[model samples]
Target chain A: MTETAGTYGTEFFVRWLEAVAEAVEREADRLTELDAAIGDADHGANLRRGFTAVRKALEEEPPTAPGAVLVAAGKQLISTVGGASGPLYGTLLRRAGKALGDDPQVTRERFAGALGEGVEAVSRLGGAAPGDKTMLDALGPGVEGLKVSFSAGRDRAGEGAAGTVPLRARKGRASYLGERSAGHEDPGAASSALLFAALAATARAEAADGTRTDGEGAA
Target chain B: MSAGRDDDGRGGGGMSAGRVGIVLVSHSAGVAAAVAELARGLAGGGDTAPVRPAGGTPGGGLGTSAELIAEAARAVDGGAGVALLVDLGSAVLTVKALLAEGGELPEGARLVDAPFVEGAVAAVVTASAGAGLDEVAAAASEAYTYRKE
Candidate 1:
């Protein structure tokens, strides 16, 4: 579906969040598998627990703004999950939320900018540049691809996710493995790509369906 | 969310009154529990806002992914909203995916990117003290910006 800017509605945003949760749940094992090869095998488990907690908390109290929801989720990640991932991922969302401000409706450009902020936060937190083989490997390219594709009127979130393969790990637990981390796609990066891909797909679908209003053409 | 009373009353009312909730996403239940505990402790005698944890199911396997997030989206009461905190890159993506799958989340569910340790503490403090979700999110975002500091 072709998603126009600002076409995303509340339902679209919720679905995007759910898609992220599902992607992480589905890949938690793979993440643990990758971590087992280098760092602790708990990456998957750690992430799983964190997301579960987020869901529970949300159930008890729902939010009113997309930015608010993201910020709360990020904080939960940090407090509940340990290690580098907790802080890195937490920063990504918090920064993204802040970039979005108090706007009730998010435009495509705003979403993109917020996500870009998230990517920047991850990179800064991990101290890794592009090609470092960490989540940044996937996130860096994924975000850039999104900007390009979205700017060009195409949604390439899925394509950006697929591009994470072949990168080496340069930071976080996987970095300890050095070249060994290469060849094997970074699990974190793969997941990051999945997140963006889902967002792109959902937004595109929502926009095409005319579910969005105010910011529909803003992208 | 409960508000803490400011002795000086500079906050206007003696009781802190704002709207905000904190969401924690982690790979380890223990870690999430620990953070939640810390947040409660930090709240001290003040009215503690809600701290929700989304992670590992007790029996193993991925319990609730997107559905869980949607559930969380429905929890908060005040007009402030909720802030999400995650543990890893995958966790971040997973939460986002859950949102996508769920379709159209409740209002005020912003994702904050901050050092989990610092962010959690800041969020709890702000939330418990009557800061709304937007204010708390802003505070958490600032925590991330100065994480290294």
Candidate 2:
């Protein structure tokens, strides 16, 4: 079938969910490793549980719309996980889901904008600035990077993840570390980068399969 | 990565056909028990999916003993697979050790790092929905990494 515009079908969104789950599973250890340095060292473990729940929910009742999938995932995160990251991260997904609003397919521009909204929600909830050395340190720039890469016809999720270094944490557990958090990358940021990377990878794969249409209507 | 058939033989999302179970491990048995209670509450009158809580045994060793965790893992892996979730620090280490000693993890078996609140909520929700262990595990992990916008 000829790929439509920026919109993705249920299958595509499901793939996105799966990719996210896999990414979290693979990197859970790394996240905990980072958190251990400054915070309680449970970021990895906490996230692993949340995503596992999301995946299970999806399996039971797969949503038809991309937004619904995200919304459901967000709800699962908020209810199943605990700790500061739970609410912060849950709010982000919930916000993204709201922004998506039942759209079955999302264009590159639209998805990027929605993600930006999600990031903004996280910033507001956490009360952290760009260089606060929290997940935002990575996500703020990661979202910006996605915008830029999408616009430039390039994918730079990895680049954004790499940029989280040299920042001081202003909120969350890491914030307590003061200047100590400056040098180390934020665990949240690293994970956020994975999210974007998964998105980019999904889009690219679809595009390669000729399942994605290019240009205006694709939005 | 097969999305195996559900109980009805219908190919839903990636749900497996085998029976599903839960394995909860925490530093304190109280914590694990609390999680189980929450799961039961959320489960309502629906199918009673097996939820094995480890680590909080009454003995003096630790809240959750390594042996208890291994047993829980084994129970979950009997059929479709088991989903493992734990609290912070040593609790996590304890569960990992149990998994290592528990022999091969079922095809769909997995360990989730979800926070106490979110992870429990997610697991309960998934169980109530009749989701398989693998699916529930995926949700727990996703919830952990989610950020609000």
Candidate 3:
């Protein structure tokens, strides 16, 4: 397993995005239901549309580099989501892609660092931190845990998303509800958790298929 | 989103070189256009600057679109600058995204932190007077202190 430290390539990213699209499709209703309680009630539908467009764009023009794939997907989401989530998520992916800098393949450690940069960009763009009942709640912890391992990242992201249930919204439209924003998980956090789960799933699939020469050993 | 360019239709000869352009961004297409109209009508300073409305999603729903905001900003940009007044959450974020990307907007485009209607009126009035970007944005921000009481 140590001989096999898996490196991620453009195909891995594309698979991750497709997995995100599928996950968003499967969970859109729940995400939207969560949003209906505290947000605009369109998180599910908006993400569905955005990810669908991303899938289409990726199919029509497959990018050669992992960074290009993420950058293109981010642009698609920004254009199609038609909501605050668009810019926040778009900035995350775009900044991460920029950090990747046309790398055709990256080690897991390098990907984790790039993802950290993406999460930081999101924090700056939304002016929100982990406790703000926003996507950063999930993404911040997820990126941190990714530095340890994929399973650790997924679990931490899920926990961070669930932790938002008790946090009064301090950012985005949910903040408009004031104290009433508590008792609801942030839709953005939920979706972000889904992204991490998809990443984990993609890694698992790649590992099972022996597509990558390196394994998840100690990563 | 809505391709909502209210334009005030006063046939403002061309983009005013010295006057900063104004854009009113809202989640509702009608609301943005109405606000733009009201701001222009209330300004009553004779179409001194272009006031464009960029509102609603591309599907004409009740969400903000970065593409629409970018388009509206470009439409009203007059080489001077563009001052955007956003209504609420996503409107503000969409404009911020465009500005952060530094694309599809004229140089000196700014998001004004002011009340939607009041800020638009003040911004239009000031821009019509051939105010620069700073002056126009300042007038808009000043509306935050406007007291009806």
- Worst ten-residue run, lDDT, model 2 chain B? B1-10
Highest lDDT model number = 3
Alpha carbon lDDT at B136, candidate 1: 81
**lDDT by residue for model 2 over A172-195, one digit each (tens)?**
657777888776777877877777
lDDT string, candidate 1, A1-219, tens digits: 234343443445656766677767988998888667766677787777677766765556666667767777776675455445665677787778777776666766667678788878666555678766666666666666666554232224334434545655666657667677656666666567666766766656554767444443332
lDDT of 2 at A135: 67
Q: Tens digits of per-residue lDDT for model 1 on B1-149?
A: 11222112224432332356677776555676688788778778346876777655434433224334444544442435668877765456555544432333445567777777678888888888877777787887788677344
How close to the true structure is residue A164 of candidate 3, measured as C-alpha lDDT?
96
lDDT of 3 by residue, A1-219 (tens): 332346777878998999999999999999999999998789999999999999999999998888888999988888889888888888888888888987777877788899899898888877887799999999989998899988888999999999999999998888989999999999999999999999999889877876353533222
Q: What is the C-alpha DockQ of each candidate? A: 0.04, 0.03, 0.64
Better of 1 and 2 by TM-score: 2
lDDT of 3 at B61: 91
lDDT of each: 0.62, 0.66, 0.85
- lDDT by residue for model 3 (B9-115), tens: 22344646446889999999999999998988988846568889988987889988887888888777666778999998778877887787776566778999999
TM-score of chain B of each: 0.72, 0.70, 0.87
Candidate number that wins on lDDT, 2 or 3 = 3
Least accurate 10 contiguous residues by lDDT in model 1 chain B: B1-10
